[model samples]
Structure formats: C-alpha cells, structure tokens
Target: MQEYAVIVAGGSGSRMKSDIPKQFHTVNGLPVIMHTIRAFRNYSADLHIILVLPEIQFLFWENLCDTYQFKERYQLVSGGSTRFHSVKNGLSSIDAVEGYVAVHDGVRPVISKEVIAASFFTAAEFGSAVASVPLKESIRSIDPNLGNRALDRTHFRLVQTPQTFRLPWMLDAFSVDYQEHFTDCASVLEEKGYPIQLIDGAYENIKITTPEDLKWAETYLAL
Candidate 1:
C-alpha cells in the first residue's frame, strides 16, 4: 500500500513571541518545517507529503522554499479555522481507499525515521497506531470544588504525533461533527469506536511551540 504524511503547521507564533510562525523558525540552518518534512521523506522516498498551512503564510513558505533550494515535492493545502478542519482539508488530497496516512505536527522536527516507519507499518497491519511516550512526571487533577488531587501517572501516556491510520478509516472518522475534545486524530478515531494502538515514540520528538522549545531544538540539532 502507499503511504502519506499530512503535516499540520497552522501556528501563528503567539507563544514563541516571533513575528514569524514557529514552524518557519530555524532550528539549525534549515526551517523547522523543512526538518519535519525531511523526516517523512527520509523514511520513505515515495511517501506523499501534504503540508497544511494557514492561507496567509503560503507566500512566506514559497519564498523560504526558494531561498533554501528545497527540492522535495509536496502538495500544499490551505488550513481551516480549526486543526480538525485543517486535517480534513489535507486528507482531501489523499486517496481514501488505497493508502495509509499519518497526521503529524509540523513543529515536531526530531521524529526519527525508525518511528516513522514503525507508525506506518503498524497502521498497515493493525488499522491504526499512535505514537506516545510514558509520563515521567507526577499527575494531578484540579477542580474548583474538589481542589487538586494527585493521580497515578502510570496510567497515563503522553501522546505524540505521526498518528497513523488506514486512509479510509481516517477519512471516515473526520466526517463526523467536530467536537471540542478532538484534540488529535486518535481522539477523533476513538470517538468513532476505533481502537487505537499506542507505540513507543522518541523522547526527542518534541513539538516546538515556545521560545524554550526552540532553544531545545537548536541545542539538539547542534549536538
């Protein structure tokens, strides 16, 4: 079966305090989104990449591609008002009946090729898979009436992306009415009664949202 990656990069740099979008920020010499795109490309040379970006940022991305001489091929889709809609738009570019699709955050530039392969292959066999890591910190639940209460962290795993699924499964799941709790593709699938398979993800597969995350990406790339 064929493979595809839909990279969602609709951020506006509010958290990073930059004039430019965070995904367009440089991690080393390359733009952060470039690194992310390369990760999927390196995993499978034939993988079709669909980059979902806010409509306003299309010109900036085009200029960056030219400046860096980015030669990898990809289809660009206009982002929507919400992440859910953005992903739905990207899925429109894919063949729903014949492939596997992985939904990824564009700021997560450090996802290893091995993890990428595992996600796609696992989804091919089991229908769906989501990358996740064990939680290392304590967990707590806060409510105004109940105050704060510590919960067992062992029961939780921090979810990451490249959430892979059979193309038809994901395409159908996205057809439902948008819910506020659909934070990730897995959440959308789970709501539709699809079982999710969680696989080990690299700890370094961090999403760069704030200045501190950019610092970490810089240091990691430098090393």
Candidate 2:
C-alpha cells in the first residue's frame, strides 16, 4: 500500500493583510508551504505529495520553488471555487487503488512528523483518522431563540487537518454532490456513514492565516 498527502492551499492574504497570498509568504527564510511539504517529506521519503493550488498561482508557486531551491517533488493540481471543491479536485488526481490519503492545509506548516505517521497508521487500522484537539477555554453557542449559553467544552474537539482516510473511501466520498455542510474530509466521510476516529493533534499545527501565526511558526521553527 502507498501513502499520499493532498496539501490544499488557497490563501489570498485577506486575513494576513498582505498583497501576497499567505501560502507564498516567507517564514523563517522559507515559504510557509515549503515548511508544510517538508513536514510530510520528513515523515516518509516515499510519501507521494499532491499539492493543490489555484490555477493562477501555479507560476508564482513554481517561481518560489525555484528561488528557494525547493527540491521536493509534488504533483500540482488546480483548485476549485471552494475549499471543499479544491480538496475534491486534489483527491480526484490520485490513481491508487489501495492506499491512504491525508488531506491537510498547506498553511499549517508545523505539523509534526509524529502526527503525520500516526494518521497513516491509525487510518490503516481503523479506515479513518481525523486529527483533533481538546479545547482549553469555555465556549458558547448562539441562536435566535436559544441565545448565547455556556456549553461543556469537553464534549467538543477542535478538528484539524491530515484528515486521513482510505484511498477508496476518499474517492467515493468526494464523488457525491458537493454539499454546503461538507466543511472537511471528515464531514464528507461521515455523511457517507463512516466513523470518524479522532486522534490527538498538536496545537502547534495551527493554520497560518495572520501575521501573528507567521511569527508563531517562526518561533516554533527556531526552538
């Protein structure tokens, strides 16, 4: 069986308040996306990486790769109008009959190799592995009739990426009509009656969406 990672990145830097896309932004002397790719590459040299980016950003990404001398190999695919569609496009490029694929956010550049390994191992054993973390702060829900009220934080987990699944399940799940509620790979798989096996994920696996996140990733890398 083979291993694959579909890295989806479509940041436009609206949150980061930059003219440059967040994925192309530099962190610790390397592009954020490069750190993300290296995280998985360090996990397994044989892991086949599938990079999903907007069609317009292909040349820009390539130029970054060249300027940085990024030698890691990855198959590039054009993203769709939405993140859901972008992920589906990435998954559709895989031709493997039997294997596991981990869908990850390319802006999350600090995912540990341990978590990446555990995702594949758990997915192979249980057919699905969705990385998540327990929340530390109190939370609440808001509605017109119900209004805001405190809820038990222990009952919920903050879902993170490398939402891994069997290759066949991934291909089949994305084949359905794109639903508005399909927020991530886990949602699509859950809709198809698959159990979501939650695994511990590091808080350091934060998505890089703002300047603070960039600074945090830089600090983490330096440590």
Candidate 3:
C-alpha cells in the first residue's frame, strides 16, 4: 500500500522564548524540522511528505530549505490557528484515497526508524495505529480544589506521534464537528468511535518546545 508522512510544523516557540518557531531552530546546524523530515526519508525514500507550516512562516521554511539544499519535494500546506486545524489543512493536500498516512510532529526529530516502520506496518494491518510509550514515572491525579494525589500508572500511556491511519478513515474523522479537545489525530478518530491500536513509541521522540529541549536536541545530535 502507498504511504505518506505529514509533518506538522506550525507551532510558535513561545515557550522557547525565541523569536523563531521551534521547528525552525537549529540542532547540529540543521533545522529541527529538517531532521524530522530526514528521519522519515531515511525510513522510506518513496514516502510523500506534506509539511504544514503557519502562513507567516512559509517563506522562512522555504528559504531555510533552499539555503540548506534540502532535496525532498514536500508539498507545503498553510497551517491553521490550532494543531488540529493545521492537520486538517495538511490532510486536504493529499490526493490519496487509500493506503496509510502518518501524521508526525515536525519538532520530534529523534523518532527511530524502527518505530516509524512499526507504526506503518501496524496501520497497514489494523487500519489505525498510534505510537505510545508507557509512563515510567509515578502517576498522579490532582483535584482542582485540593492538592495532588498519587494514582495508578498502569492505565496511562504517554502518546507520541507518527500516528498512522487509513486515509479514508482520517478524512472522515476530520469532517465531523471539530473541538478544542482534539489534541491529536488519534483523538479525532477516537471521538468518532474508531478503535486505535497502539504500538511502542520511543521516549526519545520528544518534540522540542522549550530552550531546554533545544539544548537537549543539540546534545542528542552530538551523539
């Protein structure tokens, strides 16, 4: 089956306290988004890449690619005000009616090739799949009116992306009434009663959002 990767790079790095978007920030002298694109490309050279970026940052992304000699031919989609809307915009650019489509965060460049392939194969077999890592730290639930309370960690899974789904199923999910609660594409499907199979996700596949994350990314690249 055909496959595609949608890299969502629309977020502003407000938490990073930088004027540039986090995805545009450099790690080992390459943009974080470029590293993310390369990870997918390394996994599957034939996979079509669709990059979703904010309207204001479109020129910057293009210029960055040109300056760096990034060779992939990725279709650019103008992102919306929210992550869900940004994904919808990217989904609209794809003409594929069948096969698997994986939506990944552009700032998460450390996702291993194994996880990428695993998620794709799982989605191809099960129709929908999400990459997730089990919580290692102690779990807790906090009452808004009271203080924090320890809870069971068995029920919790830290979801990461490269969330894969059948193209038709994802399209249908987006057509429904949108909500702010839809944090990821999988959530959108879950709202529509679609069962999402989970695969092991790497803890290293962290999205760079803060200065600390950027620093960590640089150190990661150094390894």
Q: Clashing residue pairs in candidate 2, if any? A: none
Q: Which has the better lDDT: candidate 2, or candidate 3?
A: 2
lDDT of each: 0.92, 0.93, 0.89
Report the C-alpha lDDT of model 3 over 18-126, residue by residue, as the tens digit: 8888898989989999999898989987999898988888788779989999987678889988888888998899887887899999999988889999998999889
Against the hidden reference, what TM-scores do the models get? Answer: 0.97, 0.98, 0.96
The lDDT of model 2 is 0.93
Show pairs that collide, candidate 3: none
Query: What is the overall TM-score of model 2 with all chains considered together?
Result: 0.98
Worst 10 residues of 3 by lDDT: 214-223
Using lDDT, rank the candidates from best to worst.
2, 1, 3
RMSD of each predicted structure? 1.0, 0.9, 1.2
Worst 10 residues of 2 by lDDT: 89-98
User: Candidate 1 vs candidate 3: which has greater TM-score?
Assistant: 1
lDDT of 2 by residue, 123-202 (tens): 99999999999999999999999899999999999999989999999888888998999988999999999899999999
lDDT of 3 at 31: 91
